[model samples]
Target: MDELIDHSFKLIAKILYFLVRIFAWLIFEFLYEEIAWWLGWCICRAITLNSRPTVGINGYDEATTTTRFVVCFTGIATIILAGTILAIYISANAT
Candidate 1:
């Protein structure tokens, strides 16, 4: 019985580890792509006149420098926070 319990625990742990890894990968990829898109938009807006005519917070000309800065900072901070959470979760499960 004890041996069976030990094996079951090991199997469950391995499954959890794999699931966590997949989840983390998907999350990070999504976040990184989003960040890249935002930063690219910021750069393109700052550099040239080639921008789509749209009116919103993300519009190239509609945003002030401070707004852009805040947006960029928020994106970066979100990525960092996600990384920190992933690290903490994985470490906690590793035991």
Candidate 2:
């Protein structure tokens, strides 16, 4: 009985660890840059009031300093937002 319980706990731990790894990969590898670029584009469009193209005439090959700043800011903001939500969730669920 004790062995069975120990095995079950280990399995649960492994599952949780796997899930965390996948989540981290999704956030850091897959979604972070894409989300940042999208948000930055939107913010730039808003700031420019759609008066001009945010991208260069050469297309996305060029990025203005302001655009870079917006992208970096949005990326950091996203990390902070995710951390805040995770903290709230963990605290709420804490025993």
Which 10 consecutive positions of candidate 1 have the poorest summed lDDT?
52-61
Models 1 onward score TM values of: 0.45, 0.43
The local lDDT score (0 to 100) that residue 6 gets in candidate 1 is 100
lDDT of model 1 at position 22: 100
Q: Least accurate stretch of 10 residues (summed lDDT) in model 2?
A: 52-61
**Would you list the clashing residue pairs of candidate 1?**
none
Measured on C-alpha atoms, candidate 1 has an lDDT of 0.64
